[model samples]
Target: MDDEPIWDVDRVVALTPSSAITIPETTNEFVIKGNHLTLIKGNQLDGRTKTDPHKHIHEFLRICDMFKYRDTKNEVVRLMMFPWSLTGEAKTWLDELNEGTIDTWDEL
Candidate 1:
């Protein structure tokens, strides 16, 4: 078998709450209520530089996709918090994101 990470049921359930999934474009600011996540027009959020709301939303969507696919919750969380530590399946998802293969909120 290939050395790719395969998602399983346990991982999906475990990582569902670590972050919010990106909701389809509906507003111009970041929105996170209950399990609904949205993003609006803006570049600066919580005083973080080079942090675009749209990009953040996309990242969340990617993470959500990883979770949906069964990537380990802990590894997914680590990738979001510390990308430098990316390895195994987490790295695969990151690569997919970079390659624009992961589906966007609208696509989902």
Candidate 2:
């Protein structure tokens, strides 16, 4: 079976409790229960915390099962993994991406 695309918040919340979800665009930690998503403060979610964006990216990569395929050669992954490297406008664009406010990647 083909893997389901996790392209939005709803899809992410659909994951089982044991599954970990990451939102590369924001600093808020998320917890889901029966389609309801709660945003937690800081990098820790349920006692799991990341010290920095770099560590968070590592955690995200593990959750997404993308570690083997991730590299600097892929620009999108690079950007998502190192959000601290982005400019203010780029950060805003990523926020819009998370909110589903932008229609296309080109809009960033």
Score residue 86 of candidate 2 by CA lDDT.
Answer: 31
lDDT of 2 by residue, 46-70 (tens): 2112224455445544443433232
**What C-alpha lDDT do the candidate models reach, one value each?**
0.34, 0.32
In model 1, residue pairs whose N, Cα or C atoms come closer than 3 Å (at least 3 residues apart or on different chains), thus clashing, are 7-70, 28-40, 28-41, 29-40
In candidate 2, stretches whose alpha carbon ends up further than 4 angstroms from where it belongs are: 1-50, 66-93, 96-108
Which pairs of residues collide in model 2? none
**Candidate 2 least-lDDT 10 residues:** 34-43
lDDT string for model 1 (1-108, tens) is 333234431432222322232323332342223232221212112213323436654655454444322223333332333322234454344433423332342332
96 Cα displacement, candidate 1 (Å): 35
Residue 76's lDDT in candidate 2: 37
